[model samples]
Target chain A: MVGYLLRRIGMAVLVMFVALSVNFAIPRLMPGDPVEQQLAAVSAAGGQTGDMAEAAAAMRARLGLDRPLAVQYLAFLANSIRFDLGVSVASYPQPVAEIVLAGLPWTIGLLGTATLLSFVVGSLLGAMLAWPRAPKLLKFLALPVVVLSAVPYFILGIVLMALLGILWPVLPVAGGYPFGMVPNADFATALGIAKHGVLPGLSIVLASLGTWAVAMRGMVVGVLGEDYIMLAEAKGLSERRIFLAYGVRNALLPQFTQLALKLGLLVSGAILVEVIFAYPGIGYRLYVAIGQKDVFVVQGIVMLLSLSIALAMLLLDLIYPLIDPRVAARSA
Target chain B: MSALAVRGLCVEFASARGIVRAVQNVSFDLAPGERLGLVGESGSGKTTTALSLLSLIRPPGRIASGEILLDGVDIARATPSALRRMRAARIALVPQGAMNALNPVLTCGAQFADLFAAHGAPGGTARIAKLLASVGLGVEVATLYPHQLSGGMKQRVCIALAIALRPAVIVADEPTSALDVIVQKQILKTLLAVQRDIGAAVVLVGHDMGLMAQFAHRIGVMYAGRLVELAFVRDIFATPRHPYTRMLIDSLPGFGARGVFKGIPGLPPSLLTALPGCSFAPRCPRAGPRCTVEMPQTRILEGGGEVRCHDA
Candidate 1:
């Protein structure tokens, strides 16, 4: 077990390095000057009357953008390892670390809850629907699940917003929390935050539940045909018990890898939903940084996101063997 | 009373093409401590009949009609809960390909423990250890997963699991077919010994006439979803009354008779269409016109056996 964990941690470090490098390199390599764009925005608003050239030069030097690419890359890498992300240009005068830290809790609270809820509910429904002797009605029900899963989250998010938000005035339309109610360390504040989080969380669930159901359905179908499941049935286990204990448990292993991928991918993909709802999450912060060319803030947030995914993937890899003894024995 | 008695059992499967008569009017009886061999080629519906006995066929498969009486109680008429109680405790099955039948993610001991727990057996772990040791596996094997074991070892674990509950009857469906020849013999020996020790009736399903002759006290030949012949093991091997049975016995390769064994000619009929007469008539060289016109009645031989052919 120790050996396996060590090996996984080693792989995680390599992955984190690659993720950070790509995150740093992509924005830098993009065509056009981010600083110039920011300057243009400032000048358009008629806020700056100083020499444009000198202002640009000073801004570039202060942000280390004028430094040699190699030196800047090295500095960024070192700063990332130490968690020393610089200040944001978009939200000027704010530290990048503070912005990320503020947003982390919301994303984790919303997405984590959605992921777990969807997995449990979807897997149970799928297992029931995939039984060899299930009625035609059950099979028909699975068809909608497959279709919904195939439809992209953005499309579903929009449809949900239109119908649930606009058509009916029952649910909150946009934003993570109510306006002017900043989250504070208090019971009332926590309760308020949870209440505000419900709508955005529901949107995420509505957008992704279909895919989870479809994937779980296929997994259950495959697991139902396995010999061990037959043996479980032959042992006189009730159909329900066999379905839940043996069938669903074995089927969930395959879904675990997909779940890990989905969680990691959500770090980036959450941007669309975050923007749609104007949720104060990491994704929304990222959007604002990119628009203002806040290089330091972008670098900091990207590194944190990448590091979180890397850590999660590492934990997932290490934990799999506990659920699946075959993997443990093989690794041993 | 016999442990299990099946009379006029038939199973049919509905498919897009048509209804398939997978098992037709199959009848058999197993007395306490009697070993019965159900011999047939692939698709002969032997497995379906076995599954029908337990009322466990998956859809679109259904037991159209049957009377499965266990110890004078009609199992076919039993409620679902009653049937579940009877399974594993009263009648257990050691299915075909036992090597892959174990849960890959569970330790062998844990799998055995699960079997005992399912049946509500007391002292599960200790009982599992005893069962494993009885099947020629060491106690250490309990901690190992299925994938860590060889094919023979896995089969042994399956046997241990099947006998864990000490069910009155154990159905082993082609249990040794997946193992090598030597391992097959060893596993078969272990199975017979276990049966002897427990005094449980065993239903051994296989196509090997020679192996059946050596282990089975009684042999029943199935062809095209119907039983063609049944007799004592020696009688079936020494003098097979049905032509299909004769062909199957003769098809077995003889020792040192290289290149001389003739395979059975013609294919088994598809079960989708209604079977007009004797299901095996099209493939039987000695089939008469009457065999093609009407289904033959099962006739009892003077030596105490049955054959489902007009000529016999």
Candidate 2:
């Protein structure tokens, strides 16, 4: 077990190192220069109009863009290890890490809850649909869920925003919370945030519900045919226990692996949904940074995304043996 | 009283073409601690007959009409809860394909715990160890998963599970067919030993005549979903009545029998269409004029056995 853990952790570290190298190379390879872009934007806005070439050179030196590629890459890796992402070019004087951290909580709260809710409910619905003894009426639910899953989540968000925000005027159409209200730890503020989250979160859950259910239903149907299920039934186990312990327990392995991968992509995957709702989450920040040619902030977001995915997979490997005895036995 | 009495058990499967009578009017009874072997070729309904004993046949196949009387309870007509209560506590099954018979993710000890807990029996480590020991498995075997064990060991674990609650009837459906010849004999011996320990009637289903000869007290020969011949082991081997049974016995490989192995000619008839006459009549060497147009009724012999052939 200890060896398996160490191997998994080592794999995760390797993946993170590759992600870091790629993050360093991608922005440098992009067509436009960050310093030149910022300088041009400032001149166009009529904020400063002096010494264009010299100011650009000074900005390049300050941002470490003037150094050799190898030196810059080594420095980038060292700084990334210390969580010291440099200043955002667009949002001058603000560190990229601080900007990313500010949006991390919102994205985690909204996307994490949405993903988990859809997985649980969809998996249950699918299991029921595949079960021979489950209610007959529940089978009809598959059609609508499948149709909803086919529609893009951002489109669903727009439709929801129109219906609830304008037609019925019940939910907030945009933003993370009410305007002019500082986000704090109080019942009223928390409730307001939740209210604003409903449209975007619901859109996400509704769109993914079908995918999870369909996958789960197929797995449950296959599990129902296994010899152990027949023996479990013949063992005089209660139907509830048989369905849960024997049926769902075995079918859940693949779904758990899929869930870990989905969670890894959670931050970047929420970009469209956050844009539709104008929510101040990491995806939205990444989007804005890319548009402003804020290379440092974009690199930081990509790094966070890659590391999170790697960490999720590592956690999955660690817990796999607990859920499935065969994994540990096979690995050993 | 008999431990199990199956009366006119007919199992059918609904297919695209029509209803297939997998087991037609199959009836038998088992006294406590008796071993009855149902031997037949593949698709001869032996496994179906065994599965029907515990009402384990799934949809597309069902017990069309029958009364499985166990300890005065008619399992065919029992409610869902009553059937559940009677399943592992009154009748258990040691399924075929021992490799997959166990839940792969669960430990052997945990599986035993589930079975005992399901029947409202108190299960502890000591009881699990005892069950394992009875099957000649080490106590530590309980802690291992199914994948960690070999085919023979898995079959032994399955046997241990079958006798865990000391049910009145244990149905073993080709329990050793997936094993090698060596493992087959060992597993069967273990099964017989444990069955004797629990004093439970066993319905051993298989197509191996040699195996039936060695282990069964009585043998019932099935041909195309019907019991063609049933008699004491000595009677079955010495004075077989039905032509199919005689052919089955002749096909068995012997010590000095050095020639081309004899195989029964002609395929068994499809059960999709109802046969007006005997199912094995077309393949019978003694088939006569009346055999094609009329069904033969089961006849009780003077020597205390039964046969479903006109010539008998």
Candidate 3:
């Protein structure tokens, strides 16, 4: 077990290293320099201080852009290790790490809850859809689930926004919470945040629920044909036990793997949904950073996304054996 | 009273072609602790008949009309709750393909626990260990998953599970078909030993005639969903009454005999479109004109056996 864990961790570290290198390289490969872009934007906005050459040179020195390429690379690595992601080019003087930290919780709370909710509810629905003993009404739900799964989440988010946020005016249309309300531990604050989250979260859950249900239904159908299922029924186990322990439990293995991968990509994958709602999450920040050419913040967010994906995969590897012993035996 | 009794059991499947009668009027009475083997080629409905004993025939297929009496209760028409109650407690199954017959995620002990718990009985660790031991498996084997065990070992676990509640009847459908020949003998021995211990009548379903000859007290030969002949093991090999049964015996690789293996001439007729006469007429070498126009009546034989043939 220890060996398996160590091997998985090693692989994750290797993946993170490659992702970090790619994150560093992509922004540098972009059309324009961050310092030049920031200066040009400021000048366009009619903000002037001194001569261009002196100001640019001073800015380069402060931002450590004046150093040799190798020195800058090493410094970048060191800073990243310490979670010091330097300053944002668009929002000058604001640390990239601070911005990421601010947005992290909102994205994690929204997308994490959405993913988990979709998996559990959708899987149960799907399992029921395949089960012969489940209600006919649940089986009828398969059609709507298939149609909804095909619809993109952003489109659903926009539709939900127009419906509940505008026509109905029942839900908050934009942002993580009402503007001017300071986020705190109070129940009212938490409730407001959750209320604000309903639209975006609903769109995500509605859109992805179908995929999980369809996949789970397929898996459950296949599992139902297995010899174990037949034996389980023959053993006189209750319909619930056979459906859960024997049928759904076996069918859920691949679904869990898919869930882990989805969670790993959650922050970045929710970009469009976040943008649709004007929600202040990591994905929303990523969108703004890209628009403003804030390279450090973009790189920080990308790096964080990659690191999280690796971590999620690592965690899956560790727990997979616990759920399915065949994996552990094979790895061993 | 018989431990298990089947009368006029008919199972049909609704396929694209038509309703295929998989099992037709298959009746048998299993004495207490008796080992009855149902042997036939693939698609002969032996497995279906075994599953019917547990009321486990799934969709597109169902028991059209029948009575599966276990402890005088009609399993074919039992309520779902009553059926569940009788299952594993009054009748358990040792399924075919033991390699995949167990839930791979659950340990042997947990699977055993489910069988016990489902029946509203406490499955103590000591009882589980004893059950495992009865099937020639060690106590440590209960802690392992199905994938960790070999094919023979998995079948042993399945056997152990079947007898866990000491059900009056145990239906074993080709339990050792996935194992090697050597392992097959060991598994059969383990199965027979366990059945003896529990005093459970077993309906062993398989196509391996040799295994059936050794392990079963009475062997029923099915052809095209009909019980063509059922006789004691010695009588089945000695004076096989039905032409199809005789041909099956002749096709077997006989002891100390050097001859070309003679396979039955043709495939069994499809059950679709209502087979008019004896379903085995096309395949039987001694098929007569009467056999083509009329279904044979099931007749009792002097040797305490039964044969379904007009000439018999």
Candidate 4:
């Protein structure tokens, strides 16, 4: 078992390296000229083009974009290993790692809570939908969920944003918190941040609920056919006990894997939801970095996203035996 | 009184094609401490008949009319809750394909505890261990998952579970059918041994005539949803009445100076369309005009057997 985990960790490290390498290339390949954009912003603030042009050359040499691609790749690899991604061109002197790290909590919090809530609710609804003696009206719910699931997350986010932000104006539409509020650990500020988060989170939940329910319904209904379920029934287990202990317990196995994969995406945040709500999450920050031609910041965010997913998958593999003992027989 | 008595049990399946009469007027009585073996080909309605005893048949299939009296109480008329209470407490089933009947995630001990707890007789580890021991399995076997055991060993766990609550009637549908010949015999012996120890009336369903002849006290021969012959195993074998029963006996492999066993001539009739007369008449050698025109009712022989044929 130790050897298996060690091998998995080894594979995870290799995956991280490959992903970071691709992340390093993406920012370079993107259309914008980072140095020129930075120079233009600085010159516009206070200086002549001639002096700023010389400063741009000096900045390029300092940032080492003047070197060959292979050499830069090695430097990025080493710097990433040391947790040192270059300074963001969008907000110069601030390390790319720092900006991404600052936004990490918001994205993780919003996406994590939204996805968890939806999966729990959706899976419950799905399992109940497949309930052997489900009420007539409850069975009809499958149609609406099927229709709702087909709507993509971004479109749903935009639609929700328009309804709540523009039409009703019931919830705050933009930013993580009020512009002049002094953010603190106290209850009021936390509440403000949470209130601001409601729309984006709701968008994510609404967008994903249908698919999870549909998937779980299929799995639970399929498990209802297994011989063990028949045996459980013949054992005289109550309808509720049989549904939960035998039905849902076994049906959740496949969905649990899907859950892990989805949760792994929490680090990236929901780009569409974040953009529509103007929530200050990593996804929105990523949008800012791209708009400001901050290549290194984009690279850092992508690297963080890939590394998290790879690590989450590794953890998933290691935890499978603990959740279901049948996997232990084969994996051990 | 018999442990189980069924009168005119008929099961039908409603499909897009039509209403298929899967089981037609099947009736029998199983006395306490007796083992009745049901032998037939696949799709012969043996499993359906067994499942209906507990009212556990799947949808599209319903018991059209029947009286399933367990210890003289009719299950067909019992309320859903009452039926649930009687299921594992009064009657238990050792399902076919023992390998798949257990929750893959659960250990043998968990299955035992689940069954015992659900039936209002919660069992501890010591009790479950003892039950497993009774089936020739070690106490540690309870801690082992079903996949860890061989096919025969899994069936043994199923048998141990079947007798755990000391149910009055145990219906085992082809318990040994999925195992190898050697393992099948071992499972059969263990099953009979356990049933003997508890003295539970057993209804063993299988396709092996020779094996059933040895283990079962009486045997009911079924073909195309109808019981053609019902008799003591000795009487059935010594002087077979129904030609279908005769065909089943003749088809078994002989020991000394063996000759090729002649299998029955034609396939069993479809349950969809209505039959003019006897179902086996189209396949019987002595099938005549009257046999085709009218179905024969079950006739009681002088010695001790029920034969459903015109010229028995």
All candidates: TM-score: 0.92, 0.95, 0.94, 0.93
TM-score of the first chain of model 2: 0.93
- lDDT for each residue of candidate 1 in B198-267, tens digit (9 for 90 to 100): 8899988998888989999999999989998999988888899999999888888878667797888889
Scored against the true structure, residue B296 in model 4 reaches a CA lDDT of 92
Residue range B209-252, candidate 3, lDDT tens digits: 88899999999999888898999999989888988888888888
What is the DockQ score, from 0 to 1, of model 1? 0.63
In candidate 3, the residue pairs with backbone N, CA or C atoms under 3 Å apart (3 or more residues apart, or in different chains) clash, namely: none
* Residue ranges of candidate 3 with Cα displaced over 4 Å: A28-69, B255-259
Output the number of the TM-score-best candidate.
Answer: 2
Instruction: Give native contacts recovered, as a fraction, per prediction.
Output: 0.66, 0.79, 0.95, 0.70
Worst 10 residues of 3 chain B by lDDT: B253-262
Cα error of candidate 2 at position A113, Å: 0.2
Ranking by lDDT: 2, 3, 4, 1
Per-residue lDDT for A36-87 in model 3, tens only? 7778878889996679788888889987889997898888778778988888
Q: Compute the lDDT for candidate 3.
A: 0.90
